[model samples]
Target: MSTPHVVVVMGVAGTGKTTIGPLLAARLGVPYAEGDDFHPPANIAKMSAGTPLDDSDRWPWLDAIGGWAHGRAGLGGVVSSSALKRSYRDRLRAAAPDVVFVHLSGDRALIEDRMAHRQGHFMPTALLDSQFATLQPLEADEAGVAVGVDGTPEEIAERAVEALAALPEPAL
Candidate 1:
């Protein structure tokens, strides 16, 4: 039997991480975790106030998510995280060595429009630029797929699943 991978649905704000992660998890028959739920109140407050978080503010949040990923390791699961920087992804990989990422990619204009229309979310449209500036696309060596976000959430999740299937399985 093939090993089940813990999938991290990643992208900038409004790239549909929250929306797609659960669908992807459902498709994969794994539990889904909201990355924002891992953040401390302070981090949420900072972002809610239109302030972008620095590395220091992110470590704990990343650690919390990492811990959850670590626990879900072999059993398989899905989680949503912005994971904008290479270092942040590295931290997650360290915790769950076999985890794979599904990066929801899209142009700035579309993402900004989505953010503007979304309600009750902590991240503001004002922070969208910062998110783009911080995003570092997955490198060649990373065990991940960059799926475009130009379709409905179900379509995007389907693309992600198809892309993930194309990846070479990790060596034991």
Candidate 2:
């Protein structure tokens, strides 16, 4: 079992994908893709206005992330996305079978705190519940780490990377 190069940093809003994704990618010597980049203009506007997006607004963004992750994984890159629903993850897997989804778990209060502290982000704190409402924790069948983010950013990232290290590499 070889280690998968494709990884998604996931969780509800404010779980720190934006914070840790780049560091992880740098450690792995791969470029990191921000999931927000794939969002349609309308979707961005909706979120920017503190509106929660329904599945209809999400499918296209998820598909784009799927495509980007698959393409990058084939070339040994990593992506960070908040693929909230199981169906979304499934859609992503359809494109990037080799992906490992790293789940960043934390309490609503903590996430809310982080979101409140964050500045100049399009995602409003008001949308936190919608994010939590949509979030589906990673399952046993998924290949990845699920770290509880009730600690420092370094600790959380370290735990995730440590977990990733423990996964046996698939035979090349």
Candidate 3:
């Protein structure tokens, strides 16, 4: 049997990457990894202090997540990442070339409102602007789909699955 594709549930913070990732993984019958868990303590500390991470602060974190994705390459998995920049996504793709993304797209107002209501997340609502500024939506050459984050987690997951299923199978 052929191996399944690993899906990267990506978006800016407060887009429900954490909520939808597990559901998407369940739908795909794959394990789920929380990208934030891979961050170094320093990175977490910086964010918790309301400081935005620069590229230097993110490289190691991205590499850690990439390593996990690399390990699950053939096994299939769902991982969450606020893969805001194209360069960040490129780093992930370098580790697992076949990994596809499910970008959770939504309006700034909606995301900020959700962020404000969330509790205990290290990423502050203040960083939402930076995230939006950094985001580079998937390009035509990228193998992924964008799903609206305007509904319940279950509904969004279903839409993600449908969109992913509709993608043309990647060339081996």
Candidate 4:
């Protein structure tokens, strides 16, 4: 694609979206945005307390991230979001029509281990099951690819880049 593609690093909690997002953005020479930074304090508090966010708590937050993706459309950027539901991805696509998702997927055991070792994140290991349950993998018609999180952050980002390269260009 001649225009820059908005690449959203999406997955369940603890899948390393934040870790790999900036790397992928750097590799593609685009701006980077952190999805967590866009969350409202209430959402953070809820997640920190081990409560899974309901759709009511998420719509506004998702809109904010979608707005960011909209702002970066055509110019490219990487943003990390849990994007655990198909409807959530659809919301983002509405804002940024050309957005492409890179889903970092992994087994529950591996994800839980990663969450346990994580520090200072609002999302706790207790909420991982909810995140997984909420997640809907990219559908065949979606403009995205699912990359396994079986490697180091760098390796995963590299794999994402390769996957993106292999895909047919998103419609302009």
Best by TM-score: 1
lDDT value, residue 72 of candidate 3: 91
RMSD of each: 1.3, 2.0, 1.6, 1.1
Q: After superposition, which runs of candidate 2 have C-alpha atoms over 4 Å from their true positions? A: 1-4, 170-172
What value of lDDT does candidate 1 attain over all alpha carbons?
0.91
- Candidate 3's C-alpha runs over 4 A off are 1-3
Question: Residue 88, candidate 1: how far off, in angstroms?
Answer: 0.2
Best by lDDT: 1
TM for candidate 2 is: 0.92
Question: lDDT by residue for model 1 over 5-40, one digit each (tens)?
Answer: 789999999999999999999988899999999999
Candidate 3 lDDT over 1-172, as tens digits, reads: 1458888999999999999999999998999999999999999999999899999999998898899999997889999998888899999999889889999999999999999999989999989888888999999888899999998999999999889888877631
Tell me each candidate's TM-score: 0.97, 0.92, 0.96, 0.97
Model 2's alpha-carbon lDDT is 0.82
Candidate 4 segments exceeding 4 Å error: none
lDDT of 3 at 115: 94
Candidate 2, residues 1-172: lDDT per residue as tens digits? 1443788888888999988887777766678888888899999999999899888998999889888887876565667788888888888889888888889888899889999999988999989989998888887777777888887777777787788888766511
- Residue 36 of model 4, lDDT score: 93
lDDT of each: 0.91, 0.82, 0.91, 0.90
Candidate 3 residue pairs that clash? none
